[model samples]
Structures are given as structure tokens and as C-alpha cells.
Target: MTAPAVTVRTGMLDCIQANLALLADRWGEPLRHLALGAHLRFRPRPGPDGLPTVDPPPQTHIRQARALIGLVPRHVHHDLEPEALRALSRRTPVVYAVGDTHDMPWLPYAGRARMEHSFLVSGEAGEACVEDAYDNETAWGPARPGRWRLPWEQLPTARTAVEFTAPAAYRAPRPAVALDDPGPYVQAYAAHPDRLTALRRLTSETWLMARARHLHAAYREHRGESPDTHEHLRRWDRLTATAFIALRRAERGRPVPDSLLPDLAAALHADREVFAVRDEQTEPPDPT
Candidate 1:
């Protein structure tokens, strides 16, 4: 039998988003298991000379998913490589990791591929997955069914290896968006650390209706006029709810997963259950 090619090489461009843009986009495609979607990207930007610059872009590929799902971190954290494998199982039957190995060469994992039908992660980053079964890969290796790690020098004399910074879009909040330092608006708008205060305030039951009334009444009492009845209490409610949620989450920790944050944000949309009031139960907390 003929042996498979031991090495593979492609332009930095194709390798850039190919894993995520092409492979991870849909069925028959590979999926990304990133936890905290940082600035790490393969997309290039305009360079100083106005030419297409494929050089390294400013980015941070966070090894873990994130400290919080919605202003709070999960109780337990995960390593890098494993998270991606687990996330891919949701849509496709298999998962493949191309880069980011600590001490070795490029590594690809197929044994841990997940079938979307049976995926069931309780409360971990989608990227927060099973650690690679093999050692950390360094470069590229022969293409195979499972992880393939290689070194830059291992490439055939004819093959060459180049390096560049990949571009990316920000999905999860990073250190820059710290929660403790931001003000009320940020606390309300973001899910960063500043958001911890916001989430906590929201789930803690601040009674924004009364606060609004108080603010309005104060305005009325002072101006001898009606309250601000614009019904634009969303911002205020969001702040309260977010803070409360943050506090509760900080105390107990753990939310669904990073992938689910987008869906959760869509559902909240400043709804009463999510923002204005707790969606749990009006009857009261069940005391066991």
C-alpha cells in the first residue's frame, strides 16, 4: 500500500480562518471550541503601505472560554485544546484541532470527536472540552484520523513554514473590560467584571419600579411637574438585574456555556422575567 503524504502546507490566508470560517461554519465542516472569544484572528488588515498586510494582527487567543457566561464565571474552568473538540460535537460528528499546542508541534484530535446528537455539557465553556489525549503538539504532522503534531524543522526540505498573527472578532469579554472599574452604564450594558455588579443588581431584586418612581417623584417634587413617565426604565432595570445576577453567580458560579450566551442575550432583550423581574417563581424560594 502507498503511504500518505507525511506533511501538508497552505498559505497563511487559507489556514487563517479555514478552520473556523470554512470548517466550523456548518455540517460537514469543523467547529471551533473556543471559550472566551478573544481578539485572536486570521483575517488581515490594511498595512501602513496601504497593501494587504498579512502580518500578525493585534489579538489575544484566550486559552479558556471565559470567567463568566453573563457576568459570572462557571464554578470550574477548563484547558484549551479540549474545549474545541467538545464544541464541534454539537453540529458535526467529528472535531479537529489544527493549532495551539504548548511544547510540541501541530496536533489534530479525532478520537474525541463529538456527535451533536449526544452532546450534553452541563455548565462549561463550549471550548471547555476534554484535554487532548496526546501530548501538546508543536507544528504539523502527517494528516491522519487523530491528532498530528509536527515541528517547523520537521517539514520536508521543499516545504516552508511561515508565521503571522491571525485576526478575529470579539465575542467574550476580556481583561480590558474589567467589571470592578466600570460605571453604572457599563455595568448595565456589558457582561464583563463591571457587569458582575450589574448582574448581581438585576437578580438581587432592587425593585427598579420603585426607584423609577422615586427618581420621578423627586423630579416632580423639585420641579413641581410630572415624573419622567417615558417608560424608558430598561436601562435602569438592566443595571439592577445584571448586578444581582452577577452577585448570585459569583457566589454560586456556573452558567450554561459561552456558546449559549448569545442565545441568552437574545431572550433577555430587557424582558421582565430577565431584567424587570426574576423568571424563577413568584411563590417564593423552596426551602429544603
Candidate 2:
């Protein structure tokens, strides 16, 4: 497959995900499969209830993030070292830490909140130029779909420790084999609670709810009064409610009824479209 073109620029997580999509394309697999495969590898067996489960290690996000970016991350908790500084000086992109939103005076959460986060570091000349989606603000609140950049020193060091690494060779179970047996992916999705898995589980009710709410708000504030936006929200809400029911049934080991399968499938397709990169390349459908 040709390289997946970049989509709308966004914050750290979204940017990482976008980059992952590109890398997954390079690896001859879908981003969702590559990401879910990483999470699944950490937890490969079924629990007592016959559902898959995993005891997530500290900062599982790093692993999922790295998987999505197709890189092996190196964690730096202390101050930047000489070697690290030299690495950042390179033309290649890297990840950098931005302590908390509270520490960022320009952000809405300034003086009020803190969220441990990181952003992408692009080209570095005398000072590194970093890009982040969080810096962009709109009337409703902080919105994504756009990105901005500034010098490296301008960013706050919230979590003095952060993870960084260059892209690595893609290594995971073959896509066909993994999809044929989805025990690992299912378990990984339900067992761990994080943004990475949530993004990977595109069909899950929780993921749909979060994405729908964000888009719903954006439409109301930014898109002006449009019946289509309202209708979209209503449909998303209805689908979200039903998906939650399906999720609950699955969690309880109760089989999802045949009647709800079509709706669930539709929801998945809609979710994909919302974030789908509409380029010249034809992509494969979700196997889940």
C-alpha cells in the first residue's frame, strides 16, 4: 500500500495516532490492527468469564503510543541529558513532554488544571520547533483538527519524565492470523482503560460516545445552526446508547442479540467515516 497521507492536524494523542496510521500503512497493515495487536500482545489469555483480560503495566499508554507511532520509545524521567539533547537536535521528529495544562498559561486550563501530556517535536534548528493540537482554542473550548507550534523552551515540563524514541521496524502477529483469532484484541480493549485502546476499539460504545460528544460540540459551536449536525448528534447518541447495551451484554458474558448486530455494524462504519482520511487510496474495512 502507498503511504497513508496525513489527515487534519491535531494534539499530541491525535497526532501520534495519525502518525501511527501512516506507519501502519508502511507496514502493510491497518493502524487499528497494528495498535490493537500491540495491546493484545500484552494480554493473550482469557479470564475466568471467558473474556480476555490483561494486567496493564504502569503507563500502558506509552506502549500503545509507541505501537501507534511504529516506534520503540525510550523513557526520560529526569532532566534532558546531553545525548538526548543531541538526538532532539536531529532533523527527525521526536516526542516531548508538556507537564500539565495548568502550567500552560495560554491554555484554557491555565491556573486551574493539569493533565500529563506530550507533543510532537519536529525540526530543530537553534531551538526545537514543536507542534501541538492543544494550543489551538475555539469559542466552545479547546478544539482539535488544527495544530500550532512554538519553541521547545516555551513548553512546560509537567511530567519531567517522558517517553521518546525513533520509529522501529513493525513487529507483531500477522494481521490475518491475529484477526482470525480476536481473543487478544477483545480482551485488551475491555481490560485496559486508556485513550490508546479507546481509539483502537473504534466500534466500542465508550469510544463512540467520546468522539460523538466532541464532534457534536464542535458542530454546534463552529458549524453554525445546521440540521445535519443536530441529526448527526441524535443518531450518534442513539447509537451510543445501543452500543453501551451491547458492551454491557458482552461484559456480562451474555451474547449480543442477532437483531442488534446490524446497528452495531452501522455504528462502526460511521465511526470510521468520521476519522477516515478521504484520499485517493482505497482502504480495507475493519475486521472486528
Candidate with maximal TM-score: 2
For residues 174-204, could you state the per-residue lDDT of candidate 1 as single tens digits? 2111111113322233444444443433332
Off by over 4 Å in 1: 1-213, 227-230, 256-288
Q: Can you write out model 2's per-residue Cα lDDT over 1-288, one digit (the tens) per residue?
A: 012134322221231233333333444433332233221122233432333433222244455545333555565554553345335446334555435656554456656754444444444455544444432332237633323344555556534434455464654322111112334444354456552333223333333243424433342233232223345456656665555555556667676544443553454345343333233223322222
The TM-score values for the models, in the order shown, are: 0.18, 0.41
Clashes of each: 50, 2
Model 2, residue 221: distance off in Å is: 30
Models, CA RMSD each: 22.4, 12.5
Reference-based TM-score, model 1: 0.18
RMSD of 1: 22.4
* lDDT winner: 2
